[model samples]
Target: MSIPAALRRRTPRGTPATGRGLRLPVSACVVAAVLLAVVLVPLLVPLDEQAVDMTNKLHAPSLAHPFGTDDVGRDVLLRCVYGLRVSLLVGVVAALTATVIGTAVGAAAGAVGGRTDRMVMRAVDVFSSVPHLLLGIFIVAMFRPGVWPVVISVGLTHWLSTARIVRAELLSLRSRDFVDAAVSGGASRWRVGVRHLLPGVLPQAGLAAVLMVPHAIWHESALSFLGLGLPTHRASLGNMIQDARGTLLAGDWWPTLFPGLFLIVPTLAIASLAGVWRERINPRRRSELML
Candidate 1:
């Protein structure tokens, strides 16, 4: 049977079919692998930094130590894996917290749509005016360095963008036929907003949450690097990188290199997945890509 050319999807010039087809799966696998490692690695492998052997400090990468040894003889590979666990934990928790807060605030403001909306949006703008890292630094500085503090700081600082996205989505959805029909059918603003609007925003909220993960991870890493995040006793990508400062300058690169790769790879994979998701959700973009 002959198919219509209009319905046929065409690849962009110079793009490899195999690469395009595999992009999503590869990104999914990378994300899943990182998540699995974060969850299961601790149970399967022991990472005891205190059990360090000074004799092996700053060793280069070898079969016995894939990522080499850190300044204290702790296994770089092990620490990187453990650090990944901490980063992922903070990122996921903070992103979820931000999502919840943002969704609630945005939904309320968008549904009410009056002085209430103006006030809420003004507040969002005020918060957005401050650099997130600076605000995060200020917030974390007030408390002792720990995972929870970083999570709170990151979550509080990151919610503004999500709130804006959610609010815009709600406002757009407000004008839709279903929403108008519900309103015409004697639905109160509260009922219409909650029953009709909230559910409609969940998918966008979810994608926002997913995309926030990498940003949260970087924020936590920045805090840790500045000695304001998780304690030194814990493994963290930022702490690891910070600790490797001297070693990196002294000609040993693996200490800094490996942890960085761990950080960069997972974030990139997540971002790729998020991009795919965004395209899927946007009808115009989806159609453009198809044509």
Candidate 2:
């Protein structure tokens, strides 16, 4: 017995096909490893008792002080790791918060169209009109300058983009035959929205969340750099850069350079992962790649 020509497997002409289905990108792996180290390494390796060592201050990079010392004599390497942790924490929390809010608003607008959609979209437009950085600064300043304030400010300001993305996704999903069938089968709007519509929107929501992380991180850093985010005492990538501003003129570059690299690497890695994810999720892109 032999297989028919029409049923035979067809290899893509100009591309090599692998047996592996979907593999994580190398950039994602590196980003995950870096995040894991940032979160866990500090817990495992005991920090120096005098992380703020005044006597060892301003020492250049050495085996003892790999990232050199800050103006206040704090170990730059230890502080960098801790700062990375803080930044990552803020970014993840803010992104999650935004995603939740966006999903809720988008779902509501999509499930109930006409006047409700118009109202919600108008509100989104209003929020989008304001410069996010200014809005974040104002929000942070209105309350006391602290972690929660920065988290809330960034989270609130960044939701508009996600909301629009999710709304579009849900609107498209709402018109699908399955959704229509579900509605006709005695499923209430709420039930259909939750059971059918929401599930379909999750993938887009997830991609939006991942893409939001880097933006949130940078937003928090900017706020901190401008002295409106985390307090000066707190170790954050933004504050580290802020602390280095004066030192740059004194011919010392390690303080700013190292922290900047620390910030940039993970951000770029996550963004690359997001691009890969976007391609994976887009039907047209997926189909083109498959060929």
- Please name the candidate that would achieve the greatest lDDT relative to the true structure: 1
**Model 2 residue-pair collision total:** 0
lDDT digits (tens) for residues 1-291 of candidate 2: 999988655533323445222334567677888878897877897876236777877889999988899888988888888888888888999999999999889878876789999999999998899999999998999998788898999899988888888889988988889987997899987898779988778989999999999898898889999999988888888999998999989989988998898899888788878876886788776776666
Q: What is the TM-score of each candidate against the true structure?
A: 0.91, 0.87
Worst 10 residues of 1 by lDDT: 6-15
- Relative to the true structure, candidate 2 reaches a TM of 0.87
Model 2 weakest lDDT span, ten residues long: 14-23
C-alpha RMSD for every candidate: 2.7, 4.6
What lDDT would each prediction earn against the true structure? 0.89, 0.85
Residue-level error in angstroms, candidate 2, position 265: 0.7
lDDT of 2 at 286: 71
Estimate, for each residue in 16-126, the C-alpha lDDT of model 1 and write its tens digit.
779767879999999999988877877887657445889999899999899999989999988998898899999999999999999889988887899999999999999
Clashing residue pair totals per candidate (backbone < 3 A): 0, 0
Evaluate residue 38 in candidate 2 and report its C-alpha lDDT on the 0 to 100 scale: 90
